[model samples]
Target: MAEIIGVIEQLWRYPVKSTGGERLDSVEVDERGLAGDRLYAVRDGSGRFGSGKNTRRFRRMDGLLRLSSRLGHRLDGPELFDPLGRPVADPDAFLRAYLQRPDVALAREDAVSHLDQLPVSVLTTATLDWVRRAAPSAVVDERRFRPNILLRTPPDTPPFVEDGWFGREARGSARSGARLTFVRASERCAMTTVAQPGLPHAPEILKAIAQAHDGRLDALAEIAMPGRLGVGDTLSLV
Candidate 1:
């Protein structure tokens, strides 16, 4: 039996890693997850990718959250843009100038994975609402989390509902026919506190998650069946 969980509230794709994303009504998904999500990333001389925090595979880079990237109409590749909405002629040069690191350049994801974790990230409206209530001062926008799919749970549903969805399978109730398997609880990160357009630098959001949820929120999933996903699609667990 499949139990209805919620409606698909929004769909997002981050064409470039560590930068802003664009909302879409529909998107194609496959084993690699969203078609153009994170196809490109800022690579440093050390081969580390740009990220909010430093790690073995990533280098902490500032001002990435303020920029945005989107796939071209033909889905060829991501086109980079600056905070002023100007199209970057040379992404590498722009990055070098913006970050003041001449060695850092824009490059496509090769053997290394650009994503922080799983291929797909899932978030719920209830969780966002709970974060808002828990951290009254912080801005709890979905952009902070950068989920590929945002499920809109029922109004009465409690927060952290996705915590129990691990190991379960879900399918969309629409013609696109996308299916997913919840793999694990997505751990919260410092990226959630990064400032973006219309969102201020708010560390309270992550602090609340650490205190209340042990630094984890939402679910990280993988595509069980490749297909299309659209807004307003009903998501149900099988």
Candidate 2:
């Protein structure tokens, strides 16, 4: 038997890694993850992917967040837009100019994965509500967390509900019948506090998470069954 926990509230796809993304009403989930998600990334001369923080595979490049991407068609790659939403004729050139690094270019992910952690990141409204209560003054938005799937739980559901979802699986109550295993809780990072176009630089967002939630929020998932997912699909735990 499966228990209904929530309805899918939002679907997000990041065509380019470390950049702002587009919201969709419905999307296809595959073995790689949400289609078009992190399919492209800005690669530097040294081959590090652009990100908000430094890592073995990523280099700190906050300028990437100022841009956004939209997937036009599956046959072609996604298009990059400037902060004002104007299309860039040469994404690679624009990245080099914007970041003042001529060696950087927009490249597709190859053998190396562009994802910071797991394939899919999930967040719940219950946890968002809890963050709001924790930091009554700071701006709290789901975009900061960059979740691929945002689930809206019942109104009375307690905060941090996703904490208990690790190792469990969610089956979509839709024709596609997508299934996902909650692999683990997603750890917090400096990326959450990085300022984007509409979002401000709020370090306190991470501070609240560390203090209240042990420096973790939401969950990372992997596709157990690949299929389509929509905003209204119900995710049931098995």
Tens digit of per-residue lDDT, candidate 2, span 101-169 = 989998888899999889999899999988888877778899999999999999899988887888999
lDDT of 1 by residue, 1-238 (tens): 8899999899999998999998889888999998889988999999999988898999999999999998855466778889877889888888999999989987888899998899998899999999999889987899999999999998889999998899999998769788999999778888899888889999999999999999998899999999989899998999
Best by TM-score: 2
Give the alpha-carbon lDDT of every model: 0.90, 0.89
Please report the TM-score between candidate 1 and the true structure. Answer: 0.96
Q: Which residue pairs show collisions in model 1?
A: none
| Location of the lowest summed lDDT over 10 successive residues in candidate 1 | 72-81
Could you tell me how far off, in angstroms, the CA of residue 224 lies in candidate 2 after the best superposition?
Answer: 0.4
Best by lDDT: 1
**What TM-scores do the predictions have?**
0.96, 0.97
The Cα RMSD in angstroms, rounded to one decimal, for candidate 1 relative to the true structure is: 1.2
